[model samples]
Target: MGGTGTTGTTRRISRSTTAALAVTGLVTPLTLALGAAPAQAAPACTAGTGPYQKKVEKFLGRPVDGRQSTADCRAIKAFQTKHGITPNAGYAGSVTWGVMDLMTKQKAVGTNPNRDGRCPVNKGRVACVNLTLQLSWIQDGRTLVYGPVPVRTGRNGDETRTGAKKIYWRNIDHYSTLYNVPMPYAQFFDGGQAFHQASVSMWNPPGSRGCVNMTKTAAKKYWSLLRNGDDVHIWGRKPGT
Candidate 1:
């Protein structure tokens, strides 16, 4: 999306074609033998609530405490101004949800500074930012949403944590006894916690030792849209929403 002139492109293609030649920069069609989704244009970006879009919109659409809107960017801006926040360059941000969560709930989440998640969006439409609540929002991966989740992390000191973090995915398996957490599942932006599918307690905050855990539902959603290097931001608490 380009500034105020945000626009996205979509292309459609046909199926059952082999040896197709490239034309007009559209993705080349796969040989029918692969059994991939047919050569079709990328879906249009709408405010619609498909399973994928719904997850994105749910986080983005909730009202700030007493105020919410699906089409009211004005309301969002007003809420931001009231909170004295920079009001974000756009609705896509890393820490927006945490702040918004506080705003609406009028409550703080996470116990330590290491807990808490961020707001992240792809460079343009390349990725999606998804965070689930376990104890703290655990740092997941830079993979497209289908990446592994629910993987275990540091217990006590090993708990997966986010914010001000600086660890890399490559180093994760080095410390784990199981070594099952994939390197790619590590969201390197935050050092401590790496993303994986694991069972962590997350009913009303402060469930994990420090790592982020996802429910079965959230793990599946995270696996669908997240990609490497999508923007992520975490806010300590919400403004007086």
Candidate 2:
């Protein structure tokens, strides 16, 4: 049910705005004008303190002073850019902080993501999806077979339904006509929501339509490890969705 959008190529147009002084044969005027022009300054980082400033600082390992600083802005901006957040002006707004908070919780999950015993251990080969942390892993009995890798789930209104399901179908080279995008290594678990490889960044905000979007490597691994009829257990709510 979910698919990624293709990125369009950006075409840059360079324009020459220098007017030649024909009276003097020398090109010194043009050279001087070009040299005299000041280099464009970089966009200023956000100066005012954001609502989640302290939280973001703590997450980034910066001093939790509850105020914005130049270093803090740069660090936060780098993180936001890495996660595909827009503007990335280094403002510790709710969206940026939300992503950080989710990461913090996911990190706390550690190596044993299924310690709660929520997913059925005796189900043989099972794929466990933790929507809260936006992670998925394959387990054989009590032994881990695959990941606790990061994933991108459904957005606000189009939330991925949580329940016990089984992999009913699989297509290595799948294409979604509805979304007009490729869904590689597609494995259908629920009615329409499936596990597939997406071109979009997994850390991007909002999230997919209804599918569990994974990296190409993770999807390839899942394609090799899982098959039709494998148990799929999904639980918890995707934060901010």
Candidate 3:
């Protein structure tokens, strides 16, 4: 994703085919003839409120209606992109569902820095930005929407403010009036501390000016999942602070 562009590419390939390619170089002519099998069709969207759909709905922070909707597809695509799943065609196919299932299992019992104490009381949707780990996560109540994604916070004297905040404003294409830089998907929580798309590498030097800088793709997802006035908790500490 470009700094100012939120679009993402999708790559689709069968999981079995992917496995076949990995073993192709070692196959003999006889082996190829005897072992090669026809590739199966890719998984399609499971639209009804079955077990899979319910799982997807849970991850998306939506009501687990048995039927799939446009909103569900959008959420699925965002999740696929976030986890590097290819051909992010917004389908809750086998691979997509499998990944989501794993995610749910991994998070079923809670994880570090994301316990009950992190979110605020009565706040339904919470954007938890953990500076110590340089990760961001969005959750609605106890359901995880997105993240633990890499981010670049304010540097040195410009450390991102810590504490509870609300996203009071949003600008899809906000340009920094103070620094004259592009701040795409800007969701301002504090005075000037917003979560925006940035081009900086998370592990490198030179961070932002009190903004939570996420990748354009991530910022787009955040913009979609978060609404104005949602709780935004900036906590923990970045290393070397």
Q: Best lDDT goes to which candidate? A: 2
Pairs that clash in candidate 3: 11-87, 48-66, 49-66
- On residues 118-217, what C-alpha lDDT tens digit does candidate 1 reach at each position? 4333233222222332122223343222322212223333333334333233221122323323221223335343443343222212223333444434
Ordered list by TM-score, greatest first:
2, 3, 1
Could you tell me every candidate's TM-score relative to the true structure? Answer: 0.29, 0.79, 0.53
CA shift of 110, model 1, Å: 20
Residue pair clashes in candidate 2: none
List the candidate 1 regions with Cα displacement exceeding 4 Å: 1-175, 178-188, 237-241
Query: What are the lDDT scores of the predictions, listed in order?
Result: 0.30, 0.76, 0.63
Cα RMSD (Å) per model? 18.9, 16.0, 19.3
Give the alpha carbon lDDT tens digit for every residue of 1-241 in model 2: 3842222122233433253322221111112112121222334678879999999998778999998999999887777666668777789998988877776666667667799988789989999998988888888999877767778999999898899999887766667766777777788887667899987667688898889998767777787788989999999999886
Off by over 4 Å in 3: 1-113
| Model 3 TM-score, 2 decimals | 0.53
Residue ranges of candidate 2 with Cα displaced over 4 Å: 1-44
Each model's number of backbone clashes? 40, 0, 3
Q: Per-residue lDDT for 39 in model 3?
A: 31
How would the candidate models be sorted by lDDT, starting from the highest?
2, 3, 1
* Per-residue lDDT of 146 in model 2: 72
Predicted structure with the largest TM-score when compared to the true one: 2
